[model samples]
Target chain A: MSASAGSEQILHENTLYAEPVFHVGQFPITNSIISSWIVVLLVLVLAWSLRGKIKSVPRGLQNGLEMVFETFFGIFDSITGSRKRTLQFSPFVMAFFFFVLLNNWLGLFPGFGSIGQIVVEDGHKLFIPYLRGATADLNTTLALATIAVVVSHIAGVIAIGWWKYLNRFLNFKVLWEIPQKVIKEPTILLINPIKFFVGIIEIISELAKVASLSFRLFGNIFAGEVLLASMSAILAFGLPLPFMFLEVIVGLIQAIIFAILVLIYLHIATAAEEH
Target chain B: MESLVSIFHIDGKLFLAQLINFAIIFFVLYKFAFKPIAKIMQERTTTIEKSLDDAKAVAKKLAETGLEQTRVLNEAKKDALAIVEKANQAAEVNKQKLIEKTKLEVAAIMAGEKVKIAQEKEESLKEMKQEIAGLVILAVGKVIKEKMTDDKDKKLIAEIISR
Candidate 1:
């Protein structure tokens, strides 16, 4: 429904970016940020309900939460191989999972893409929804991915010593070992430089990890929203049902994929030096 | 880089905002959900293990008690059988002694009765001899009308009758 805010016509269109809902003293609060805040509030309310009621013998929602946590621990255990490591990594990793999953699924709620203000912008009316999918935006996914990758490096530093953790990317150790072991193993002359170069390549790959992680999640969720919009445009009714179902499944899978990839990076980062 | 940034509308402010949001989610979940639930799960596993161990000990003790009861019963049965066998042996010995004592008593009574019968026969014979002697004397007196007494003949007749 197009409503006139002024003489300018309403521009009902989907943009690649999250639209700003309002301005808070030069700080623009976008629809995606609103969605994320809603997710945060939902968690807070759920957490508040069980604040003091967390018993050893759980009931109802607590029981369901325990089951979910157990399942998550099991799945994370497969990635980390040790339950201790799983515990170390699970909080951050599951944050990603819950944040992405809830944001993705909740994006499909009513009044997300369909309801907004008809504001005159650039001599044209634009429809800006009050909420959008949090993970569907690049900033949110990029933030999550950057956090995941950066935390891996932190975990690496904590698990291994700083020097050992640092060598994974820059690899000054192989270079240092060259003068000491080159006499006994002459191949060190050739292999150490190559290994050093490989470490440099690992640096590039780390950047690639951020890009890939962010792009992968943002692409899938944004595409799902776009696909749903396209399908709704084609036929507003039952034609989009299957795609909605597909989007649901896709939301779950993409969340799992992101969480698992983050978990793997954590594992690889923290593992002890083999050689 | 500019093109990609423009295309995605990446903003540092929004990025930081989402980071803070994710931080809130993490803190709430970690403080409320993961830590307590993990603690409870660990406790439940511990309880289950302790219960299993207790059950194992109880079962073992039960088996041991069963064995002890059987052993006590078997020992009692064995002792009972031994006592009965000892009693039967004593009864048989007592019966043999009673039978021997009865045979001895009957023999002694028979010996005494034989002695009595012999004595009685001898006494009656003595009396008969005496009476016969008297009758001979009277017969002579009546036939001869005088006392013709012959002691040797009397003695000889007496001896022959005794033989």
Candidate 2:
């Protein structure tokens, strides 16, 4: 292949992070933020338009949306084992799923990565677009994960009392029970400390949950974006099409995984321990 | 950590904005979409259940009414049968009484007619005996005028009349 002078300027490479589109004061508004705002607007408009048309006997878009809600609620119910808890957690979990999924799939559109401005930085030209996959950025996923975990704790505090919910992580109640249970069973002295250690492990696990939830979604989406970019770079026409389809499935899976995990966390947090 | 931050360009501002975006979606969806739809579905379920229950109740009532109707019809039939039987018994008694009354009237009328006939027969017999005596007297007188009075003949005539 000969060096084509015209194709060189149009060639855009995928970056590891979202490039900044503009800045508001000290805050740099990245391309991912713009994409997220667009998703938010889309969700809001859909919700608003459907708000008036929500009938008892659902029809058209209401029916489709209800089916989606029912299917997702059923999955949530399976995780939570209670419709009450599913209802409580569904708003955020569904929001996260739709938002992440939309952001992921929207990135595969025609103008997302291709159309951008070339700017010279350190004498090397870099292509920066006005929009990118919101979930491809670490911050968006981190924020979603943080919100999910935090909301689970809040739900826990409300479901069980505050002290009881806190005891899952810092179990002074278990430590205090050691003396009381020692006289009755005599094996609790050995079991109680291990239980206390598990509580500490529980705290560590909560943090791990946040990290894993954020990273898994971020890594998957980012990888898919990179893969699509690479494929497009290789052939740009027929080769990227199949990968784009694959990315859609991947995007849906990742969204479901994230939502289900959050639902599980909510279920666990709200459940009252028998002991 | 600095390399990771620089490479990924992790912005706290963007994270906050995304969080706000999510919060807006959550509230909006919960208020406008999920809540109303769920409420409507629940209401529809309750209404359907209520309708089913009402139908069941109506069916049960219909069955009960059917049983009642049969019971009432049976009672009416029994009453009608009893009335018919009573009427038949009364009619039989009335017929018997009418026959007895007619027999008594006929017997009284026949007894009166028989008594009247016997009286008339007695009167006629007495009159015939007197006529016979008158004829005997006339014959005896004639015989006396013709011949001298005989004691023996007069005694015999008296004996015949007495016998």
Instruction: Kindly provide the TM-score of model 2 when superposed on the true structure, using C-alpha atoms.
Output: 0.80
Evaluate residue A72 in candidate 2 and report its C-alpha lDDT on the 0 to 100 scale: 89
Task: Give lDDT tens digits, candidate 2, residues B21-110.
Answer: 889888887888888887877788799999999999999999999999999999999999999999999999999999999999999999
Worst 10 residues of 1 chain B by lDDT: B148-157
Instruction: Give the TM-score of each candidate.
Output: 0.93, 0.80
Tens-digit lDDT string for candidate 2 (A50-134): 8689788888877887788889888888888878877778877887888888988887788887677877676456789988988
Model 2 chain A, TM-score vs. native: 0.91
